[model samples]
Target chain A: MSKLAHMFLLLFAMAGITYLIRMLPLVFFRKKIKSRYIRSLLFYIPYAVLSAMTFPFILYSTGNFSAAIVGTAVALIAAAFRLSLIIVAVLSCAAVFVAVLIL
Target chain B: MEQSPLKFKHGIKDGLPIGLGYLSVAFAFGVQASILGLPALFSTLISMTNLTSAGQLAGITIIAALGSVAEIMLVQLVINSRYFLMGVSLSQKADATFTTGKRFIAAAFITDEIFAVAISKRQAINFKYFIGLAVLPYIGWTIGTVLGAFSGDILPANLQAALGIALYAMFIAIIFPPAVKALNICFTVFSAALLSCACYYIPFIRNNLSEGFAIIICALVSAAVAAAIFPVKEKDNE
Candidate 1:
């Protein structure tokens, strides 16, 4: 198949998966769940997924690896202090921009 | 579910920050997709259909690399599998007013940021509020992608390069607050990092398994460890 056809097929499948993952539970289960294991897993998911997506990867998401490291440190520190998300993001970008300029 | 003007307005109010955040990240996504040789309009369509960052990026990368259809499906499913858990967790908190059709439609917008805000509300969530919550972010993400795709050439290289890191920083902001709140969360993230790092550094895993699968494995290992060793016992629908 051509790339456009490939893209169309892939997107259709993506929509299916995204919809299933999100829709099934919200639609089928109406009442409160009593499973402790499920609850604990859900509670930990945000941190687990976020960390998996953030760390190590953040070290390379920028233009330069060293700049990414510098930006991430600034971001962690800024976020720890309870700065807003936009503020933290901007500051992190600035840290990288400055690092790129200096180095 | 109730059609309260006040609730819809509050949802929009709560969603602005998320929309702004999505704008920057999705803008970067558009630029990144274009740099990879995908058309801008197609990239925007991806954003509109996917509404996810990591999953969509992974998909685009695979497409650019000429991966097979099976690869695309597997990669997206693995990366986006977390949404299943989130949906399950939200099921209990969802308002009774949501009909089947509304639930299906609303679930499409159950993104991380939207979920974070929705679940934290002290009151029952309504369909109108939830729809309102997703509107601005949906608009922002789509518009940002379009702008970046068509006008990305207008931007200087340095700023474009810098914008790439915004998504990672946003993820950091999301995770940091929760990590600081609970020690168990810190442990969970730590374990996840260790697993992800191991997958990246280990010669066999790096080549043998795709990045999408590695993420799933790392997350599952950490979450399973957390659930077993430090199970949190909050009542669902609380």
Candidate 2:
């Protein structure tokens, strides 16, 4: 298959699943979903998913591993204070940019 | 209630920060996706259709690794499934002004940030407010992708390389604030990381399990274990 077609097929599958996930609950649930286990599961998914995705890969995302580490450390510190997302992102980028330059 | 122009404007105002934030993050996504050899046009298309950073990025991995259809579907289901809860939570916020059809339309743009704003609104949301709330961020994401995609040609190599770190930084900014607030969450995230690190290094597991599957396993197990150990505060779940 052509690469574009392959990409489109993959993206289409993703879009369909996500849209269903987002739309189903709103359409079906008039009352709040009261299942505590499900609720807790939902509550923790974002943190867990983002954590799994970010780390390990973050160490390898930059041009240099050391640069990625420095950038990630700076970002965590910025986020610890609940700073704006943009500020944290820029700070992390700048940290990596400088780290790569120096090392 | 009538479709109020004032409410729509307020929604737009509320969406401004989200739009600005998406512009930067989606710009990072664009650069990252393009760096991975994805065409700029498809990157923009992903943003336009998905409006999610992690899901789209993970999907890119699946595509890059030539993951199968079942793998792609399952991974997206696991990663994007949290929106199901958000949708249920936001349904209560929809006012009588919304019709059945409008509800479906509104759900199309029910994103994390958009839902946060909509749910926090003092008044029940109408279709107009939801539209204004979702439109700007949607545009910002797509436009940022376009800029990042094309900017690859213009940006010097060093700067482009630095921009790659933006995705990691952005993810850190997202998870850190919440992780710090809750001890169990701290444990959950770390455990998930450790598990993936093992998967990345363990040749038997690493060779057999794709990145998408590894992510699905790590996410479900970590969240489930955390929930069992530290069930969310009852009040906060409401």
Candidate 3:
């Protein structure tokens, strides 16, 4: 198969999987949801997903511990203070990039 | 009395920033896709169809890395798993007022930013507002990809890196507000970071795992661990 064909097949598979995962809960669980535990579990999922997505890239940018440390420190401070997301992200990225450049 | 057209105007209002933000990031993705030797149109179409941030980003990486179909599917599932929760939460906001078609349409356009803005609105999420919200971002994402793909030559390399930062910044913006009120979120963020680092250093996992799979593992593992340790009390959501 051609690379384009291969890429499309993969994309279709991904679209199907993603839609199923996202849609199932809403469609299947549409009626009165009785499980308190399930509801509670659902509440934390977003936070967990966000963390998993963002944390590692911040640390491993330069393949060093220090860069991650400084980047995390800057992000934590900025985020904790409720700085704008763009500002905090730019600062953190700049911090990592600069740290990598300097060290 | 018919609701004023202005009632729906907010969707466009809120979507504007999101649309502008999406342009740069989507463009970056297009450039990356081009760099990987994929046609620019492919990247733009993916953005149009998927309308997801991390999933698309991971998809390109996985495709470039030449991962298997199973791995790609699994990675997409894992990376986008949170949307399941978001969809459920959104259903509550949508209430029974939404029909199946409406739900599907909303589901397709539902990015984290869009979800956040939609849920925050005091009014019922009418179709008009939802379409308004989806349209601009869709245009921004598609056009951005096309532009990036075509202009790959003229753009400076550093600018692309800077544009990539918009995505992370968007995440921070989304995560910060709620995180301030909740300690679990902070822990979850840190835990995710730690897990990601471990995945990076661990030779076998680093070498064997595709980016999408790595993301799935990190998200599920960290969320699972956090759930176990800090199990949200049943009363909290109530």
DockQ of each: 0.62, 0.77, 0.44
**Superposed model 2: Cα runs more than 4 Å off:** B1-6
For residues B20-121, write the lDDT of model 3, one tens digit per residue: 877866776676576656677777778777888778877877777666799988877767766776777677767454678677666777777788787776
Write out the backbone clash pairs for model 3: none
Model 2 agreement with the true structure over A1-103: per-residue lDDT tens digits: 9877877888898888888888787777668777788889888888788888886888888768888889889998999989887889899889888898998
B2 in model 2: Cα distance from truth in Å?
16
Computed on alpha carbons, the lDDT of every model, listed in order, comes to 0.79, 0.83, 0.69
lDDT string, candidate 2, B1-238, tens digits = 3343337887798889899888888888888888888888888888898898889889887876666888989988888878888888778878776777777777779788888888776667878878988989999998998998878667877788788878777778888887788798898888888887888888999889888899889988999999898888777763
- Candidate 3 Cα outliers beyond 4 Å, as residue runs: A25-28, A59-77, A89-103, B1-7, B35-37, B95-97, B162-166, B172-181, B233-238
Interface alpha-carbon RMSD, every candidate: 2.4, 1.3, 3.3
Question: How many clashing residue pairs, candidate 3?
Answer: 0
Top candidate (DockQ): 2
What is the lDDT, from 0 to 100, of the residue B39 in candidate 2?
Answer: 82
Candidate 1, B39-118: lDDT as tens digits: 88888988998899877877777777766677777666656766776787677777776888888888889888899898
Output DockQ, candidate 2.
0.77
- Fnat, model by model in order, equals 0.67, 0.76, 0.46
